[model samples]
Target chain A: MRLKLLGLAAAVALLAACSSDQDAAGTGSVTGATSATAPTTNAGAVRPGTRQDFEVNVGDRVFFGFDQYDLSPEARSTLDRQAQWLNQYRAVTIQVEGHADERGTREYNLALGERRANAVKNYLVARGVDPNRVGVISYGKERPAVLGSNEAAWAQNRRGVTVVQ
Target chain B: MTMSAFMTRCDRLARLAVLALAVLVAGAAAARAELRVDITRGTVQPMPIAITDLLGQGQSEGQIGRDISAVVSADLERSGLFKPIDKRAFIQDLVSLQQQPRFADWQVLRAQALVSGTVEPQPDGLVRVAFRLWDVAAQQHLTGFAYRIEPKAWRRVAHKIADQIYERITGEKGYFDSRVVYIAESGPANQRVKRLAVMDQDGENNQFLTDGRSLVLTPRYSPTTEEITYLSFFNNRPRVYLFNLETGRQEVLGDFPGMTFAPRFSPDGNRVLMSMAANGNTEIYAMDLRTRRTQQLTNHPAIDTAPSFSDDGSRIVFESDRGGTQQLYVMGADGSDVKRITFGQGRYANPVWSPRGDLIAFTRLYQGRFYIGVIRPDGTGERLITEAYHVEGPTWAPNGRVLMYFKETPSSDGRSRRARLYSIDLTGQNEREVVTPMDASDPAWSPLIP
Candidate 1:
């Protein structure tokens, strides 16, 4: 019963956080919002949302399979939302960071990470984000989000994160 | 003439002949006084050697003298070629630089060779070190040398003395008088902070070159200069940076539109080879330092990186996945005759050509383990030197006698992974850990400094 109460509290807190995010977007810039093709319904603001908002609402990251850079359907869906959020904030520029698991040579993983980041950038550009606004950087296996050598940690580490600049 | 006169003349001729013979024998003995030991094969058991504490002259007894001797002893010990005998077994104590060692006593202790030296403080605030090598079996002096240097460089002086002895005995160049530049890592597994560090080959005089605010990797030393080319992640943009040790200056290699990494200096240190990615395709590029002009070496759609030049700078070996899985390839300096050099079941990467131009060291991964190996340029006589759970980034010592690489042990609890540096001889023997203050990797040994 205590676990259920805690779950309810967490849901309420999440809803409150999302509503506050929408309120901030609504009061932000209305001019940039007017210029975008489809402004977010809750916010008539044109300014780009915070990186935290993009991560929480639009999904800031996508994962790839082992030694592979091709995007999956789930990854494509995440990129689509990222594109919509990027389009909503016309004035903001973003940098895509590609990372890899610690199973390969440092130099080779560096190249693999580059391919992964560029794959995301290409997908987002096809989904209507400007190519000039999106830059890519690869950290290789140096900055792993997860630390373990297990499959779970490796899967989480092989990801691309988009950050607003 | 009478018979008695004839007998007297014959006796006088005999005396003259004896005198001539004696003079010739004396001259030959003088010429052969300097003993020599021919080392035709590496010893299974290290030859026993005794290095006495170097006596200090006109100074505080044996302070610096003992320190230098300890460094020299440690260097010879780490080489796995010499076993320093205990001083307690010595029958005769070292007293003065001018006195000759009682070779019979060293022979009694079963020492094959003896090293004795003296340190004297000079009037110009420098220390003069003089050492002599003795062959116990021959009971003769083999070689000796003297040098005057600042007291602060005592360790280098010791290394120099050790190198001289090593070369004289082994008939090969010694790598003691060298430095290594590597990436020093610290902190938790997830948030590792790596910095560029330089130190003596035996893990002394360590100094960090970078502040760890930016991540650094794969520092390659120039064969002819005190400069290194490494990859850095400053401002979240990964680029190749060239750092000069003497000048304490750092600069980005080129103004690329995208990321540039995996850098190495040409054999002559005139150019740098690196990989640059654009529009998701990574290719090898070389830049001439004198003209500041860049040239693309590989124009393939597949990734071609980690380009290491041969000693003559005529060819390069690199890793690529153009044929499906990662494999090594050799090509001319002009990017012609690109032939795959690895065709085994596993993937190979980071092919570094030996300074002797005979073998290329590389990292191999197969069946969930990583290996450090060497192969001929023609992909013949492939030999795996060492294996670990995860090993990569093999760099050759200046003499090409040893290869240094990094090994990582995975954390079972997912939070405390450990990495360390290790080295092995080219013959796959004498595998030893190069202890660092913290986790270290990507070691690049500098050529013997002038």
Candidate 2:
């Protein structure tokens, strides 16, 4: 029984490490990338600069209008860049997270967030990215990128973020 | 057997009142008039009632009697049907339970009804409470009863007495003997800590059932049992959990691979209806508790969630976005013959069918404001009852004559928000704020406890 408990603890630690690595690849790469020429080392290696390059050159998220699930022209352009990035990093699976402002009910906002996430997923799939490589989750208004309640803050919070896993 | 004993005592009191009235009429030439009130039309003008502080019988100046009497008065006053008179205006001080109140003194204060009671502390940590209701004008006792309860349950005894008096005067069922289970929230706007909490209807005996380690939402009580079903974000997965209040035991409803939310118990408390999201689509599902069998009630491609059963458990009213936006829809229990009910300008969500089965209460969003409204089951007679900056999650009282919902007021700095519970009558009047210790939301009213 003690051995089994140790095995479970090790498994949980591994999962925790993997999740933190994914977070580092998404948000921590901007400052952690040591060199710009690291992509020339190996052909199949996951280049350390891949995430930073995508975030700096191509956007990571796209904003939406109030209570709207349809993508704007700029949002489509961002999805085009995101599709190209995902195709280049073929081994990378990405999760598209949808969010909403704090204006609607909690349950309805969840549904609206799902709609927004799926809209982005469909746009990426239509642009030739593998559909199986993309997953979606709706955080609703629970996790907001901005903390204010005004129009400017709301416009920033109502967005869809694509994170590589 | 206890009920029959009380009824017999009531009979003897009525006979004694008749005899006393006959002697008084024979001695005085003036005709004796019986003060009576016709309460059939409802309480437009609240009747003035005076509730005396219950005297301690076996103990000297016990604090329990005073506390019980105060709670009883507050319960009746909050109902909007009765106004408790100021105790300072009482001309005669109640010293014992057996002493009759001077009717002329109560009449001088213009009180329509009077309540007097006594409390006796027992040796085994139990207390005996006896109370009598009197008509001030008629100089006769209307009702009397006694209860033996533990000292900890004295508030419940007070609420029971208030419920009885309310029923006798209003011709309707009383909601005072009820409790509310809701999410007690605190912390900043960005990260709010919500825990499951239960308290009496007047915000007494507040107790937290869950630690604030996980995110919990929409705690609803079973109509027939002391169990609650809510969504918990435990282990980074949102699932529906059933919590037994009596034993403090909790179990996950099912081993679903996806997220389940917006759980509500069926009117019979035998089934749980919730929304499950799979493959980027959300649908409504129901599971029977006895058989552990799951049934998909809605197969819509759009988000169909917040399913609530009607009073009879034959039909379900839920919110669906199938028609391009969020709206209210009604369907059969077997998920047949779906019909859209609301065609208003704003979005409608969280449609809870009234306990009386006549109307459905829902939260509406329009023009950047939230409103709590009710509509008939047939999609007609829509009325927005209360409007606020942010209002959602309408739960009905057991009697279906009132609704309780949460309202949030945004701060000027936008860093902190205050959320509180508010209740309003069915006719859109008597809007009052229910006080809580801290910020609170997602109030679910329990059925009157047996």
Q: Which prediction has the highest DockQ against the true structure? A: 1
Predicted complex 1: CAPRI docking category: acceptable
The lDDT values for all models are: 0.79, 0.77
Residue-level lDDT tens digits of model 2 in B204-309: 7678989988878899989853789998877656789998776688889998877788999999989999998865688999999999889999997888999999
Number of the top-ranking candidate, with lDDT as the measure: 1
In angstroms, the error of model 1 at B119 is: 1.3
Candidate 1 structure quality by residue, lDDT tens digits, B243-275: 876567899988999889999999888999999
User: CA lDDT of B247 in candidate 2?
Assistant: 64
Q: What are the chain A TM-scores of the candidates, in order?
A: 0.71, 0.71
Sliding window of 10 residues with minimal summed lDDT for model 1 chain B: B13-22
